[model samples]
Target: MISTRIWNALPGPALVRLLILLIVVAAVVLVLFEYVFPWISEYLALQETTVEET
Candidate 1:
């Protein structure tokens, strides 16, 4: 696949390539949790309501 090809093209030895891949994955996860999650939470936030006694 394209990703495999891209991965093969990366510089450095196997261990270094693995480290770079891990770092990239970690960065993506961090970005999603820190920025994307908060942005999504704003739109999906739950609404609070009070019940009136009759």
Candidate 2:
């Protein structure tokens, strides 16, 4: 329902649609890098496992 509503609301032009899609993708990537990645790094133990044995 929400997706359909969004689809229906979008402009009916190929170029405009592409622009909107690109803007949305850019915003999502920005949010992920700025907020989500930093928040997730605090919980992951990725630094605890390494190949160094000295």
Candidate 3:
């Protein structure tokens, strides 16, 4: 049974290109979130806080 009509409307080559583009974009986002982004945030937070004086 067919569920979607839009896939049938698209040419087969276009569908494959769309899937590949989605995968590459998802990978780029994950790399930034896991490695580069957290370090920048931590450095900024540390700069904002004040040390206690004895």
How high is the CA lDDT of each candidate model? Answer: 0.88, 0.85, 0.73
- Regions more than 4 Å wrong, model 2: 1-9, 52-54
Provide TM-scores for the models: 0.74, 0.71, 0.53
Model 1 TM: 0.74
Q: What is the C-alpha RMSD of each candidate to the true structure, in Å?
A: 4.3, 3.1, 8.2
Best by lDDT: 1
* Model 2 lDDT per residue over 1-54, tens place: 996776667897867877887899899999999999989989998778878778
True-structure RMSD for candidate 1: 4.3
What's model 3's lDDT at 16? 88
| Model 3 lDDT at residue 26 | 95
lDDT of 3 by residue, 1-54 (tens): 352554455456876857866777899999899988987888677657788999
* lDDT accuracy of residue 27 in candidate 1: 100
Please identify which of the two predictions, 2 or 3, would achieve the higher TM-score against the true structure. Answer: 2
Ten residues in sequence with the least summed lDDT for candidate 2: 3-12
Compare candidates 2 and 3 on lDDT and give the better one. Answer: 2
Q: Residue 39's C-alpha lDDT in candidate 2?
A: 93
Which stretches in model 1 have alpha-carbon errors above 4 Å? 46-54
